[model samples]
Target: MRPRLPSSPPAAGVTRRGLLIGGGAGVGLILAWALWPRHYLPNLTADTGETIFGAWIKIGDDGHVTVAVPQAEHGQGVYTALPQIVADELGADWRTIAVEPAPLNPLYANALGADELFETARDTVAGRWRDAHAVRIGMMVTAGSSSVRTFEDDLRQAGAAARVLLCKVAAARWQVDWQACDTRGGFVFHGKDRLRFADLAAEAVRGSLPDALPMRVNEDDTRLSGQSLPRLDAPAKVDGSANFAGDVRLPDMVFASIRQAPGGSSRLVRVDRAAADRIPGVLQVVTNDRWVAAIGNHWWAANRALDALAPRFETQGAIVTSATIRAALQGALDTPGRRLAAVGDVDATFKDARLITAEYQVGLAAHAAVETMTATARFADGRLELWLPTLAPAMARDAAAAAAGIATDRVVVHPMLVGGAFGANLDHRCAEQAAILAVTLKRPVQLTWSRVEDLLHDRFRPPAMARMAARLGPNGQILGWRARIAAPATGQEVAARLFAQDAGFRTALALTPSGDPYAIAGAVPPYRMPAYAVDHHPADIGVPTGHWRSGAHSYTAFFTECFLDELAHLAGTEPLSYRIGMLGGDARLARCLSTAASLGGWEGGIAGSGQGIACHSFRGSHIAVLVEAHVGEGQAVSVDRIVAAVDCGRQINPDLVRQQIEGGLLFGMAAATGGSTGFTRGLPDARGFGDLGLPRLADTPDITVELISSEADPGGVSELAVPPVAPAIANALQAATGYRLRCLPLVPGTK
Candidate 1:
């Protein structure tokens, strides 16, 4: 039977009464009914036996209370970090407490994602920090650096409220006045009377939300404000049975391997399925726009059949090679057509003062997470079910629902643990494809993208071309700045959206030079320059683009910091001291710079080893990086040391913060050095690991030092670690060799 087609809308844009408005309303109502206002934080209780220092405590009929968190664990350690908050506040034994992924609740939305909505006017650590608690919409998600900040209030309140409720329950059962019942070590007490929290838990659940709850404080309350605690998930992860998305398997499910056109522009002109069909367990051959799938009883059989299937594609034009993109980027630097930022008399400043200008070219990069893109979808009875690891599942849910012609409520999205995300899962092609095939055949299907296709067709971090020019006064202050950046057309759109979001604030602040960060030294005028201005000229290309680990900030910081270092050298001052002095009024910038410098042992002097630093504030966290590298013979740049410091106020788990920083650095390093997804004549040129180079264990640096300041406002740590790495490394290389490399990858041996 032909699949039932969704009826077309009657009023052009409007669909059938029940299918459009009513269907959406029904879904919304269901969502509302399933969630409650204070639903974000659920109360955990001990049974009938024991309790700890009142924290992580559980006196159970069996003796246990387990904390629950809903944050997605995509290798960022949110699962491990958030529980630390509960343990710290409860003065509980951290070891005895176990944590489970919380059910979907409205309360989960209060953190980082909420802050993103509040940060509409600007994207910065300060912005997120200032509005962390005011917003509400509890849906647990892991994005930005909100896991700790979002749960800070709710979790603390839950623990404190639980304590109050336990005392109330104990006092009522003992027939004593509430005041007479004092609580200590998870037990309620009246003179010569005591009842453990485990015994009182059942009664406590009958009480309402506690209004007044006691708080835990350290010898110095401020010290614990941003204290680092051990990661909660580390023990389980070390014990060997942690479940990742790839580990999931359903009964009677079959495996599939898919192949797509090597050239993105090519379409399937033909498919010779005779040989593939003869394979023992090969179930079917499914072909779509650019994808051809081979389904079999096992993954190996599918893979073998996929390899045997002969398909041909017609090329659109000459392959738009990497050399072409490189050349185009260089050309864009020569003549900028569109300006995104402008302030003061930029032309006058450049013409009047001593200046330097250079063009930097960056290559494509990949999110080569060890786990390839994979998904399982079961389509039956006009309903679709998806099980995959994704960073943006809401969008996926909508897409899957629309495709299946079913109520979104009928679509169930189960988020699984990811081995790695690195911003790649932001798009859900694999899940969509898997669902489409399953729906077409009315059977469950699991599709996996081969590493070759992943590399060849992967959406890459937009390649960028940046032109930097600066004018300095005789007093060692910067007078003017000009930057022209061009990337794929999609980047311009992303930039436009980001720029538009800041338009109102930019107009209100009338920030000098540039309104956005990294524009005119984040508009702080690093070196007191009069008649200052900053401008951006948008250039366009054909490559598809989206956010990488650090997004645009990564490339922007490299250009801004490297140029600033050059300006410092011309002024005859140490780069560290020069930047520090430039940050005259920005205390946040100054603090991070100072801290990072201190961590890197910035004492000056190694004639060839120069210190390079860059500071940025994103998603409510201010981070600064310092790099010390020896750029010796062979043009082989070896970073001897790297120091990263972040002030992301109130750390729930210090170890996770450190790990995120490490991951961000490694991710950024891959982009800076060897990572590339090159194409030719609009066809992918790079095909696999060998073609698309990534940082290997052997390529890792000697040492990396991380220092986090939870004392300050908490902002996101995931991507902040990346933006500064490239610039820091570039600045150090320039300091050491006295020859600034103006392109990415610095080309192994060519400087």
Candidate 2:
């Protein structure tokens, strides 16, 4: 069975080269969508000639409302939440609303997600808007938990504009003033007459449109934004109707299996192509400088052929082991690092003040998404088309085009439903590989990486080490704080790969004073400190590293929060109370910390028990977690209960927010327990979940979550709850037993 392509129209000639080729004001309109909207009119229309409410929404003659979700749906309920924003503002019937993945277009780029990565842009409103437009033109990606936060306003405005146009059309038809018309339940109504949106959609497209329209203020009576609407994608997913990349099958499509060099940088010497071709059902053998792949009619046959071929590679040098990588990281900590954040005079204050010091380390971890990397590519008529799960569709399209020797405009990307990403899908190597094979063979090729292949080649989360030294005052306040971290810079690695052609340009850019935003994220404590300095030493160990969920915050929060707990213990103060004291003016952090404490029944001490609390703010969300655990015999730590409080300002869906928080906690707990991706002979040793020591259902704790309601704009919630869980659990274990655990994977016999 062949997979069907989406019905969305091809994007107009919007690229720089396209603009030059198609000269006129039409190019300006295309550029405007990439830059900023100057008019409020719905610019897109459906095949039925019905009006489309901006790039995200479409109205049909049959009264169905379809929302094009720009972000990839990876079980986060984004497909449902994004449309809810539009339907709520448009006064449309929720039952009539359907969601579809938006096409690869500049209009759907993730501006908010990019803003989170750049500090200067995130700090100012004008800068954020400017960067948003820049991201729209160049980087169309889905990460940083910005799906809702970035597109909320635009989606609302789109719905509001459509409603305004519909009302005007209805008013003209009824010979009444537009102001006398009202919209409700996908209908435009006069004093005594009402018409469905389908009846007026055609007229609305031809009617006079407004340059701008105000969105209806959400009232308590008719508001749906904060309400717990059922996930629109839930039924399909539950019934196994959801289409992931693995589920995508095309007619006459061949399957491919790849085997890369064992060592990180080894070179593929050669492969017995004749032997692989002799295998039953094997169609072809593709070999590159570093990898060999086998293609066949079925995945099993392709995999079998690849294994039978047993391609060999030439070793680059001495194998790099886990011990060597750890030693290098530790050595990096001794060097003077580039300062990320500095406030007040830390050196002078730390010279005479009472000081406390601790060093923390975290090992490499994998995204380990449910579905491995997979992509299907087809080349025909000098164009390349791909179906895959990708966080960055634009980058994938560009890479595929480059690999296929075609223009970027000739490449089409169909983003399939992601089984799960956790920041791993940002790289499009699988798509590129499939595209190359498809172009080479002149037939459709579907490449699916085996579990072992996926794990071994995964861009694992960078292992990091941090050393913290704090100066305490006579009153037990933090007088000065200094933190130095050593880790591979995700930004540097990604930039170098993306711009591999211009080494001089990359070097010049790397030499700039700007820090690796991801490496230093959440490195500085959020609490009020008189003198603080945070530094980062970028160390590129042999292992490949990329962004994991929450990026540096995943490990930095654990480092800083555990150290803070140690300081509190040193000061003989309660952990929760000490955090609250440092958080003076930040009411949000304080509220979350206090709320979690209250929910977890924090009353100084639980007789014969251990309780720990941790709080952090990331990507605009504030979250706090409390863990109650007991260290059983053999030093095994069992968490009895965990409580969390979150304030992600103006929740889109309370249920989804809670789900994200719970999921994030589980993810963090797995990493904290025994999720290290160790290396042997310069290769990843973890082959599957068992080797990674993933947490099971029996290991889960009794979890409770409390959402703090607010009227502010929506904030990111996807990764906000992850950073606090590890620290809280580690602190609880430390409290249960009088030994401080400074490294991750707090297993038995580890200190």
TM-score of each: 0.80, 0.91
Give the per-residue lDDT digits (tens) of candidate 1, residues 399-457.
56665666656776777777675667756668778877878777787888778767766
Candidate 1 ranges beyond 4 A from true positions: 1-63, 90-92, 102-106, 110-119, 122-141, 174-197, 210-229, 262-265, 315-319, 327-348, 351-354, 489-539, 603-607, 631-635, 704-710, 748-751
Global local distance difference test of model 1: 0.62
Could you give candidate 2's per-residue lDDT for residues 581-697 as a string of tens digits?
A: 999798998999889988899866333457888999988889999998877766676778889999899988899999999999888888887778888877888998788888789
Q: Give lDDT per model, in order.
A: 0.62, 0.80
Judged by TM-score, which candidate is best? 2
lDDT for residue 166 in candidate 1, whole number 0-100? 71
> lDDT (0-100) at residue 589 of candidate 2?
87
Error of 2 at 474 (Å): 1.4
Query: Each model's number of backbone clashes?
Result: 39, 0
Give Cα distance to truth, residue 627, candidate 1, Å. Answer: 2.5
